[model samples]
Target chain A: MIVTVTPNPSVDEIYWVDRLKIGKETQEEYLTRATDSDISAGGKGINISIFLARMGLENIAMGFVGGYTGHVVVRALRDEGVTTNFVWMGSGETRINLTVLEHGREHIPILIDGPGIAVAEGEMNRFMRRYRRMLKVADWVVLAGSLPPQVNLAFYYELAKLAKQAGVKVAISAGASCLTHCLPAAPNIVKPDTREHLSFEWMKLGTKEEIISAGKRIVQDGVEIMIVSHEVTGDIVITRDSIWEINARVQTTQFRNLVGADDALLGGVIYQIYNGAGIEQALRFGLAAGIVSAESREKVCRDMGKIEREMANVTLNRI
Target chain B: MKVGEIMTRDVTSVEKDIPVKELIFILDSAKMSNMPVVDEEGKLIAFISEKDIIKAALPGYFEMLHSTSFIPDMNQFAKKLGQIADDPVERHMHSDVICVEVDDDDLQAADLIIRKNLKSLPVIDAERRLVGVVKRIDLLHHLL
Candidate 1:
């Protein structure tokens, strides 16, 4: 069974206000009445696991959850019929991130960083030991998204190495720090967005060609698959065996929030891989998942049947 | 008729520091779907409906004296109330209060009752103080 590990899982609360006023207090000059709020459990891997569960995939989601917020996240998962095997940390609640949007159209979002959790080193070791034990039972161990400050970026690389040694295929979906550290070690697959691609160049020493060259060079560095998602450009590149260029399908109508698109992509990739689809097919699945997210008002893309139907309409080219 | 003429001044509210358990008691006693959570200055801050309180307390909560006969933690429930209540009412309260000014037509309040899908709308003064609440039942009385 596929195993998804989310290091920093959160209860994502998305809400809408007719007019969101920030910094200054807004008084009702006698007008608007109420706002709408919808909440869900979200984190990259948790999201991926939810989508996988929706598709009737057999997998267990493992992660860190503590305090009251953890309880909410678990309840949310159970409500969706997804199985979770989370380790409860001693101190602090699981983080709650609020994605606040004003009305239906405004693109601006107010994201709360949430409260931090405090864990002792011993507690960390205990969690790691439990994770290792769980990993031993997993068929494909997928490490997705950022970890809480309790663990280092190296911890992810080390965990991937451990999984690799145990013959568990390791897939990492991360940005900046963890991506930089893990690239050299080379996990089975690394998915980076275009924003991440440009950020590394701006932050570190590199040009556009240099970064593409570096991404290309990593094929020799032991990474089996490199998926570069250019979201704004609506295309994804699968650099393995040969370069495969896949474009996102155009939306039939107006789209909603862009949140959880990447996680859906990852879910599509994992689903394809688990079903024994080749790399090219898996890449197309990932692209379709990302594109389908725009079709729904909620942005979580709950309908896999719709996604598959939409994917058929999307064309894939081998470059 | 004026908004104040039709509004109910006998309104019930909870303090900023009242525990969630006590709020549950108030909710149970008031038989209210929603409460106008107010501050010491009597300004409407936030509101906690039965639904909001239940969603917060039910998930992952344990009762210490579930089997005991003694007055179970009213505060156990109140602790949740306190958690929600401890914050400033302004922080969580619906600041966009659908209010009718002092001299507005009573018909406007009736429209608000139907359009906003609110059981009641707090009628306020120029300073935004809670003057009275016009319930749907009261508006129905006017219609009758």
Candidate 2:
């Protein structure tokens, strides 16, 4: 079974509108009705758990949740057949994230930040106890998303160390200090979340060569697989034995929503690797799943046949 | 109310290739009379119920008609079950399953359940994926 941890979960609300008006100078009331809207559980690990469960994989989701929004997250995960083991906070509610998609301009979505959460000492201890127990039966553990407020930057590092000691493979998808601090544990797979930044550990990822060098640096530090986004349509995968570049033959115009595509890619790769696929084949399937998610109206595509059909459009070249 | 509003979203389903023994265990443990059979993409393709298992264990209609004096004993049922225990549930499941969609009226689901004598109806989406299940008990409880 797979175990996933999301430090801070959210209730993601997405609205689709024909057009959005901004910076109006006239003193008039304007109303923009949404064409459609949807709400679901949101967080990096939560998204991965949903994706894995859709594929009929047995996975348990662990995190901190509270209030009405927390119940929404648990219900959403339960509906998808994901076992949730969330620690309820004592004082605050889970945050809500909003995404606005405009017609004919879905390539660029408007994302709104949600409120941050502060984890108390008791809550942190409770989560750690549950996490350690889950690792005993988990074949793989994924630590993803940003750290909550008042949480240490090395939290992922501590979790990764515990997982490694239990002989569970670790896959981390995080950004900034949270990503860099876990390097000492030598996670099996690392996919640096590059949505907020285009560099890794002070190294720029502006070109293919630069990405390859940065990825190799991480692999040299004992990470089995290191994936870095090179562009919107391509990614670079580096390992101890070889380096490969994967590209999806998809147009920007075909994208309907790109919010959860990255999470799907990581989930897809882990799913394949857990099922005994080679690294090259796993990366190819991951890219196909990512492309399918990007082209769908849903945040993450749950159709396995659609992903299989799109695999022909993904190409992998050894660098 | 729409089917989506009142349906039980946490559905327990199995794939097409599960063994009959495992299927029976799941049904007994979950206390469910029937279970939907989905494909790899989670689309509802068939359904299997406790009635189907009993039918499989019983003698054929022609055989029973041939010998009206013959009564089905535990030995007969056990032998029949043993023959198919290792077989996949797909061999005996009903491929033409009756289902409702999420946006359908709850009255429509009630009509189907009462008319068809079903314990529950699988609720699907536009893509025919199994999203939830609407049970007859749930419909009656909603009335109160």
Task: Tell me the spans in candidate 1 whose CA falls farther than 4 Å from its real position.
Answer: A23-35, A102-110, A193-198, A201-211, A251-253, B1-144
Clashes of 1: 9
* lDDT by candidate, in order shown: 0.67, 0.85
- Scanning candidate 2 chain B in windows of ten residues, the lowest lDDT window is B61-70
Q: Candidate 1: deviation at residue A7, Å?
A: 1.1
Instruction: Report the TM-score of chain B alone for all candidates.
Output: 0.67, 0.92
Listed in order, each prediction's TM-score against the native is 0.63, 0.69
- For candidate 1 chain A, the 10 contiguous residues with the lowest summed lDDT are A200-209
DockQ list for all candidates: 0.01, 0.04
Q: What TM-score would you give candidate 1 relative to the actual structure?
A: 0.63
Q: Can you give the lDDT of residue B110 in candidate 1?
A: 89
Per-residue lDDT of candidate 1, residues A81-129 (tens digit) = 5655566666678888777666555333566757446556854654566
Q: For residues A54-101, could you state the per-residue lDDT of candidate 2 as single tens digits?
A: 988978888888777888887799778786667767767889989999
Model 2 alpha-carbon drift over 4 Å, by segment: A24-29, B1-144
